[model samples]
Target: MIQLPYPRLNVIFEALRYEALPQQELAQRCDISTRTIRTDISALNDILASYGAQIQHQRGKGYHFDIYDETRFLDIEKQTKKMKSSPRNAKDRMVYLMMRLLSQEEECKLDDLANQWFVSRTSLQADMGEIREQLEQYNLELISKAHCGLRLFGEEQAIRACIAHILFQFKPSDHTFIDVCEYFFPEINQPSLKTDLLELINKNHIKLTDEGLHHLVVYCGVALHRLKQNACIHHVDQPNLSEEAQKTAAELSQTIESLLGAPLPQAEIDYLSIQIAARRVTGVPEIDTQKPTEQLELTQYLLDYVNTHYNYDLRNDEQLKRDLLCHITTMILRVKYQITIPNPLFDHIKRYYPLAYDMTVAAISHWGKHLIPDGEIGYLVMHIGVGLERNFSLEEQLPPKALLVCDSGTSIVRLLESQLIRSLPQLTIEKVESLRDYEELSKVDADFVISTEKVSQKNKPTITVSPIPTSFQLEQVNKLILMNRSHPYMLDKFFDHRYFSVLDEPMTQGEVLKKFSAHFTEDNITPIEFYDSVIERESITSTILGEGIAIPHSLGLLANETKVYTIISPHGVDWGNGKIAHVIFLFAINKDDYEEAMSLYDLFVTFMNGKAVDTILGCHSYDEFQYVAKECWFNRKKDW
Candidate 1:
């Protein structure tokens, strides 16, 4: 039941003194026209929609009101009694109660509800009329179906968001401290934290509670984040620390060990100390603070970015401010290495919230005044396990300087240099110096001295393997270079080759030739080339293996054990004849076959087809390649 505060509405409502009968019966009993009663029914339904209720008509029965109220507005009056109450307080209060009842049942006996509210049924009906009007604006619907319960269903997350809205309205800003603390440290005032903290604090000389420790950490994270924002990654120094800076470090160290149960790494400790010092110095606002001025413009840009760039929708309301803050926090902590998120959480964020992470990167670079480029960049992690296995190809970065030392003068050095430069693309020969100038070697800033006859330049790293270091050296050296600080985690990313195969994934030239010799021949021997002439012939084109496969191999593979590899593609790849299915190999057998075997690659493709070829390609690992060669390549099938 609702109070009909207005006198006119009250009089009209009470006028329905004899309203016990159904619509037709009531019209006859009250001596009103049935058409007039119908008019009343329609106007009454409209009023109920204003109150956030819908009136539905059953086939054989009279119409009933279905109120839509997911907000559970029953407590609106209690919430609104505070000083911040809105002018439309009365209506919102009515909406709240209606919402609660709507959650219960689609239709209840009007007499029963009116009795609970201590008002007449007519008064309750008048209130339903008010709810019906505002239903559309709120994106709600009121349906009256046969015998089913009423539900306020639209978006469940949106419905729950009303709780956040209520907190915004009546709850004081002081509660934001509670909210932030709960987010960062959910266990602070929580029963478990409180109990555990109390037990620990009792052992200390001074009294401390869970809330105290939580607020300290929360403030520390905020302060530390601010510190990192100011300290430039490559240039931060320790001379600019204040007294309070020193205190936060000591406290953080103790808390990390005592409270968090994890000892702080020395590197993290130094970084945090620097940030704490930086936060005390006042300087430019972080990247996002200084802006292009228009408030609405910035908001709209954020909205568009959120909607289009990300998979999830961002809140368009004032709450977008909070989302922006979260983005900033995540970016600053991650980019500066101030915090290391758990590995699994990192994977989840990377997978599901890619745009969030992207936004985070932009926010960090923009605010922190860093030049980290933002885009779809990929990282490579390179490593090699065996002496004979070539793990990587180089030619990406300008190679380190090298001094090629052969006993001969410039002619011998130039010939060896030409051989290396042609085949080993990454190695850059700085100079070809004579053996007598070994004392002058100290002057050359070369990374390595590559030589046959060893000269003494102990300061420079030397790789002493003929004119050619093995292919494994090339792979290992490149991987080693990637591990240095200049590459920034490059060696931590694409280091996995176990999942790739010649039959499965397309590969470089060297993998194919090495693979075929390792399998097709009984000796499992691959030719190794020491000069440039052997490699130049095969670099011209591909060798198609046939039947939906192509192995574009290099004569470089037959040169050594490390150059041996297998590459396969089942999609019937192209060579120059419009298409090429497969290539068995490009073999290098000493200096003679290495140059002459370019003709052998074209001859192998004409005879293979179907399962006969696939069985050759299906070998899982290196050892199994021998089995595939014996069974499929030789037309004899056997398994162990």
Candidate 2:
């Protein structure tokens, strides 16, 4: 039998067992990237082919398993279960060892552990080295007693964090803490605990995601179990709580005590307060009038930084101020206690709100004293990004203009122009006339021309459509209009010969960034602050845009003019996010050149989204790069 290598194969198969799963859904359910999931489906189909079955991926519908031979497919599923009985690889061994250490109270003998994996003691010892390194990251230790063998030793909260990490890594997204604990340690599992917890939260008016609720259950379960074993937590820093929050925490502590048949110490109660404070709990308890001076100072610093740098005034935005205060208050507690919360929207926030992310990075660097993590920075991005977006929306935006050209008469042209105006409310119709009149015009004043006749204009976007447009044609027109409305700036204008480099030598992302930064500074194209900003932005999230391309740029314009520095690595540079890029586009823009910067960026995205990425990377010289850019972009289907 060809056993599946993936431990999460069942997660995919079970999802596709009933209905088709969209690529996004599969990605979320598996907690893996969609790119990885797409690749896995292809691999899965190869395996299923032997069983006379295949996984069909329809763009709109998603992946569905089509099994020709039910018995063979069933056999494959059964084989997956048998493979699960024994750890197959290092990753599996690590997870299994962690589970063993966490679920059991007593020390694990090397002999028993070796027997469990059918490995010699020497082999198990080697594996334990890696396990020790992994545990250290969570501030947990693998301790060996003279007579008792090995056991995990850490603060109760840290150990629980390890358990939560393992649970999240191996299971489907929907599995609750109860589900995981029941599977691994049925003796301590409480099925009704989730329901009781929900009731208590509802009664206290505490708001948390289902995932957060599950997390609380695991924390409570582990604390209860450890308390029973007399392994209670100690010296936990007391979290600052509002009067309302304090009341809720007190009620929650009382409820947990009654449910677990265990008594809690003051330190344990405080730890629970920390958990509540760190999470997105609703109905915050009342607090003292005065705020923490340090947090208030930090908030004022953030508001001032935005006003000074970005020219946005948020000093009087009470809601924004209050949100920042709450976040910083909880953040201080988290930093002290080593608590972590995952931001699911981190990537989206970074991608869409580049400016806000930049501002947040600067503020954190200046105020944080080098202590905050990337995850926490993400939360700040949302707040600042939203504030900036709101301010931007208040400003007037110029609508896209379209010059309609038709070979038909005025009567037909008039009707067509009216229809186009009705269909595309966002577009400004500059003129509706014959192609002859358009040619007679010395210059095209509009962004893009919509015509029944084909016009060759390398500079502007053109859409060849029916005089009376169809739905498909309208979609094409809409895409072009939006593209034209976005900055039509090109990177070639800013592409300096001295700034560009073709590196045949193997280089890492950091090395590439360092080389590019030095060139920019030496040439006086930008100051060191620009390069520092670029590196800082990268530290928050990677600049990889997929398809073997990365565009690493700083947050704010740090140059006199927008400039792009190109680096071609025949051997791909790892750009984090499990992506390797052969072409690295590192650039910096001036604050005044933001529009041009956005245009160049949109064009780059267009190139990545099309078949041009491969061709661009294949270019041997700067001339070839320009040639490919013009040919690929202008010649691209006028649909966008």
Candidate 3:
């Protein structure tokens, strides 16, 4: 049933889009003769018509097409819907598309499919054979009876099994799904799927390679969860689960319980675990309740954090509350997942956090940090982080050691500055440009600048900040630089935490010392000593940020990075009896930069949101990754 990939369709579509072209012209553009152009145009137009759009002839123009761009999309949707019934098509594409939909929807009609595909019933029936073969790779079945036409059958559970195949394709290169899934599926820590998928590849005698299987695992999890709730509601005779799968799920449940400290209902653990494993092992996709639960938790956390930490209660307005929660969720998912930024997602974030958008982009480029949130939330950080982290100083020198530069946001930034200074002796203060003078700043000679969002460039080191950055973001920025709170990358514009709660590790004292000597400063305390000093932090709190990333350093000094050294262990270090792939250890050089460290710490927090560390690990070379650290440090410099 395997068919050669049809590159021709894309070419045909492109060729037909021309206003009108001579046979010779089309041949040049499409590398096809006038004869081929005519053939493909006919094929494209036939399909286009079913979708409510037509590829009309251009007046006197050869190879030209008349099309309604907006309406043409309807054709796409219709074709897409048709494929949903069963992966049956005149061409192989419709067959593949349809099969996926049919598998999801559990039904389709041959006559409708035939009409939509612009093919005779006989020709389409022939094509359905090809579709069946293709589905067989993932154990997909195309069950066709004389009356039934053609439909997808077999275990729906395998949907996740198939989906995990292309999860990375839907993801941006910077974020890795495996890492984020690390948090969601704590039960499968070693990523045993790597082995399982490999075995499946060999057994299926299918085309997808190990790499393909690797991604499919997560994509399947996501898709299965997405569909399990509603898409699969209509299906009959779904697949069954094996006991081996159940046992595995229970083990996973135990793991998550260990990580969360409090045990989730064992029944919930059992159900979710089975669901996750079923989607992987069985040919049927299992349902996922993780996203909904996670979102609910995040909203609650936001409300709590904002009220207690930021002194603002956004819950007063139900609409704003919902909107903001949705906004943040999408942002975190996009960045965490490292998925492309959808236009609407960007528009929404820009609509709500416009000033932070451009700044966040600038910060990423400057820091050489790559952030791919599904929307403009990543952009928002650029707006604020860049304003806060600065290379130079401002006029204000106060405690908690950061300055405020918001234009008209109720002095929240100032209040934050004051509150932070109380705990930190290194705290300093500075003037918001709106309230102070150039001369005054020169007199004070502030070490950094902090602003609510991007406005203009400053002569000194600065950290642009969001009035209320997420707690995760705060943790990352705070740990990167200790100066004030500046995300210097943004005018310079926009920018970007901590695992104070790291799990226990059993590293040898000597091993710890070597980590220090090779990477740490010559200061009296060695890395091993620091590890020992903070080892208690692990027991008290868990520091495993999602994405196979962990950060462990002296509790009091973890956020300060006056002097710096970093390590990237792709293999992941053992923490809390769990394996972590990317762990960042930081030490600050100056006593003064400590207050500025919050933003640096917050950077990690921001990244931990979804799939940050995994994306970081995907980087192939040192040159590709160093800027993230540079951006973090510069962005973390405080404003005061």
Could you say which candidate leads in lDDT? 2
C-alpha positional error of residue 611 in candidate 2 after TM-score superposition, expressed in Å: 8.3
TM-score of each predicted structure versus truth: 0.21, 0.75, 0.25
Model 3 global lDDT (CA atoms, 0 to 1):
0.44
1-640 in candidate 1: lDDT tens per residue?
2233433222223334223234554343333335555666566555545455544545555444454763532233343243122112243335334534333323545566456545576765676655655443335556654555344543322222222222222222333334433433343333443344334334432232333344323334433332232311232334434455455565555654454445555544555454344222222233354554333333345445434432223433434443334333333322342222113233233323322343333322223342222211111000001100122222355665677778766666666677667656666778766777766544556666777686675644455555554677555444333322122111112111332355566644454444454442434343333223223433333233334344333322344322223444554344543444543433333333332232222223222321344554555564464434323322311111
**For each candidate, what is the lDDT?**
0.39, 0.71, 0.44
Worst 10 residues of 2 by lDDT: 170-179
For residue 294, give model 1's deviation from the true position in Å: 6.3
Measure candidate 1: CA RMSD: 30.2
Model 2 per-residue lDDT at 552: 88
What TM-score does prediction 2 earn?
0.75
Query: Which residue runs of candidate 1 sit more than 4 Å off their true CA positions?
Result: 1-159, 162-400, 408-412, 434-444, 453-461, 468-640
Question: Backbone clashes per model, in order?
Answer: 42, 6, 144
